[model samples]
Target chain A: MEEEVVSEENVTPVDEAEGADQEVEVTEEDARLAEIAELNNRLLRVQADYDNFRRRSREEKEAAAKYRSQNVIEALLPVIDNFERALLVKPEAEEAKSLLQGMEMVYRQFQDTLKSEGVEVIETVGQPFDPHLHQAVMQVEEEGFESNQIVEELQKGYKLKDRVLRPSMVKVNA
Target chain B: MEEEVVSEENVTPVDEAEGADQEVEVTEEDARLAEIAELNNRLLRVQADYDNFRRRSREEKEAAAKYRSQNVIEALLPVIDNFERALLVKPEAEEAKSLLQGMEMVYRQFQDTLKSEGVEVIETVGQPFDPHLHQAVMQVEEEGFESNQIVEELQKGYKLKDRVLRPSMVKVNA
Candidate 1:
């Protein structure tokens, strides 16, 4: 009887071990699938981030192009003031007159440089008024002029390439 | 004898299944480890990309600041030419004389605008020669001047803030 009892305990444990082994097999397969899913999710996130990075780079380049000349122009504003001041001088002698002539040469050189760089004056007079290029401060009914036509420009506007740097201030025919 | 043979076949298949299950378990564990490693690698690559993006943005901003007024300054060159042309006129009448005065006024206005924008003329005469700011075109011996002192400025040089827009051309005292 004791020998039978000892044998029975040994067999029972063997059966339990087999059941546990099978359970481990199933769990192992599930774990592998979960790992694959997690990896795929990470790959997707990285790809998305790469796409955003490319878009931002393109935008930065465009912005850089649009405003590339802002500082240089700002610096030249004082030079413009100097030109105006030179023009205001009333020459009393021949030497002063010659100096004025030299100033004119410098002024022409400055203007030619600006033209070569794609700066254009906005034309407002005798054209149909559009809000994008012109700011209308006054309106009047004028004979032989179409309604909404710009009658005169109070201040000149300028454009660089296709972009308006300053809007024209104008009088429109009502 | 037939019953013993049939029982042996059944036992053989059970042993084979256990061996196959163990093999599958080992391979699954290895695959799990590989997946984790791949995910970690991807995470690292994304982080590196982000770092690069930030660096590029900083570079772009610096470039923009450096060249912001390039276009505007280029455009204004034409206006300078016009000023020069006006100065060349030897006005024979009062009307022409007043126009010259007007031109002088404009020139002064232009210079003041440039001064307000951080544009400065490089001083060369009697100053010690520095290669970064002055381009030496000639060397001459002059009384009461130190060696390497700038004797004259052949052409004006300008700086916008800390950056030199143009280097001064100079004659240095040998």
Candidate 2:
């Protein structure tokens, strides 16, 4: 009876060891599954972030191309104004008249180039003056003009493809 | 004796079953490790791609900004040429002289604007004729000029920064 009891005891411990081994394996597999789940989530997030970045970069590139000439055109506005003033003066001598004609052709060519680039003069004279398009230098009560009408354009304003470069300097009828 | 045989058989089968379970556990663990390594490699590749894309986008943005005014400047070159021609004429009458003076001031202002925008005239007369900067309209064996030297500039050329808008039309000595 004593030997039998010892044998039974040994068999019980072996069964217990097998159970412990199974439990350890199960725990390890669970941990690995959890790690895989976390990595998948991170990968998805990163992929989404890359997509958003690509979209934003494309939009920025388009905007840069659209407004590429804005800075140079803005700088040339004063030069255009001076050209207009100079072209208004009439020369009497034959030599100066020929020179003036050549200058007029250049001025017209400059205007054409500006137009092709989507630049346009902002209309002011006889039109209603809006603060967005015109700077009111003087306000007056004038006859033969409606109130808020632009009486004169002191200086020209310009627009480039729906963007205003400068406001027109104007006199408005109050 | 039969009972002893039965008990021995049962013990051996249990041990074998435990060994198989342990083998299965090791295989599962190895598979998880391999999966983790693969995921890590994929993540690293994606990250490297994103970094390259960002660098390329930044470079493209910089180039776009640098060459923004190139098109407009090219368009205005002929207009500038005409202005230069008009300015060379001499007026005799007082009225013509005053008109010419106004035109001269405008021309100066225009040139100043061009300079500020990094536009420059390419040297031709007395300089070595380069195909990149000068177009040889005529080749002559002219005296008092070195071989391959530009003797006369038929038309002015312009550069915006380091980029040539137009090559100078020139006469080169053979």
Candidate 3:
């Protein structure tokens, strides 16, 4: 009987110690699992963010290439306008005729270069005035034109591809 | 005595079951810990990659803006050369003089626009020949010029900012 009691005491203490150790281990394991879940969520979010950034950067680069010539073309518009005005002068003198011929050749070459770069003059007279492509400088009543039709183009407007570099200055028929 | 033996049998089975459960729990906990570590490493790497990408993208955007006018300017170089040639012709008649004046004004305006965009002509005559900025087409023994010096510029070279658009065609003294 005494041996049995001694054996019982030994087993009971060991069982209690094991129970406490298990409680601590289970809490620690639960914390580690929670950490793993949190880390996984963060990783997914970062990956998605990176993917979005890459796509946006690619789109921006394409747009930059498409519109690369915008500023230079815009700056040259006034120069082209002056060239057109100079070409309109009538040359009566023989010397003036030769100089005018040279000017006309250069002007044609310039136009060809602009055309190759996707530049086009916007049509204005008799067409419907579009606020996106035309700027009305005057409103006039003309017998041969319909309402809201452009009666005359005062200044030429240019577009590069679909982007309007300058709006056409036009007289609108009321 | 029989009851004590029965109680001991019950306790022994419970302890064995608890021991098996603890073993499984420990293994599961270890797996969770390893997963957390791996996920953290991935997150760190992804974040670093994103930082590097953002920096590279910013630099690319700046470079694109700086060189945006490069292609248009290159295309216009031949046209400018023709304009310069036309301006060199002297007008004898009154009408030719006025036409030349208009052409000169337009040419000046064009030059101003180019200058504003950081375009500059490379110096050639009397300057030491530089392979980076000058292309020697003819070597000549010219008087009053040092050896390896540029005697004349056959065709003008241009640069936009620090980048060479074209090297000057030059005659260098042997």
Best by TM-score: 3
Q: Give the poorly placed runs of model 3, Cα more than 4 Å off.
A: A1-13, B1-22
Sort all candidates by DockQ, best to worst.
Answer: 3, 2, 1
Q: Per-residue alpha-carbon lDDT of model 2 for A1-174, expressed as tens digits?
A: 100111232344456776575456445656666676677777778777888989999999988887789999999999999899888876667877877788888899999999999899999989998999999999999999999999999999999888889999999999
> TM-score for each prediction?
0.74, 0.85, 0.89
CA displacement after TM-score superposition, residue B38 of candidate 3 (Å): 0.9
lDDT of 3 by residue, A1-174 (tens): 222222243245575866764565556666776777889889999999999999999999998888888998899999999999989998899999999999899988888888888899999998999999999999999999999999999999999989999999999999
lDDT of each: 0.67, 0.82, 0.86
Flag the better candidate by DockQ, 2 or 3.
3
Taking the tens digit of each residue's C-alpha lDDT, what string does model 1 give over A1-174? 011111122122467766764565456556657766877787787778778877887887787676565555535544554555556667666755676667756656665566565656789999999899999999988998999999988766766667777788999999
- In terms of docking quality, model 3 is acceptable
TM-score for chain B of all predictions: 0.70, 0.83, 0.87
Candidate 2, which CAPRI tier?
acceptable
lDDT of 3 by residue, B1-174 (tens): 111111233245456786676456545645665676679889999999999999999999999999899988998899999999999988788899999999999999988899888899999999999999999999999999999999999999999999999999999999
- Residues B32-133 of candidate 2 have per-residue lDDT tens digits of 788877777777787788888999999999988888899988988888888888778777777778877888898888888988888999999999999999
What is every candidate's alpha-carbon RMSD to the true fold? Answer: 9.7, 9.1, 8.5
Instruction: Write the number of the candidate with greater DockQ, choosing between 1 and 2.
Output: 2
Which regions of candidate 2 fall more than 4 Å away from where they truly are?
A: A1-20, B1-31
At residue B126, what lDDT does model 1 achieve? Answer: 89
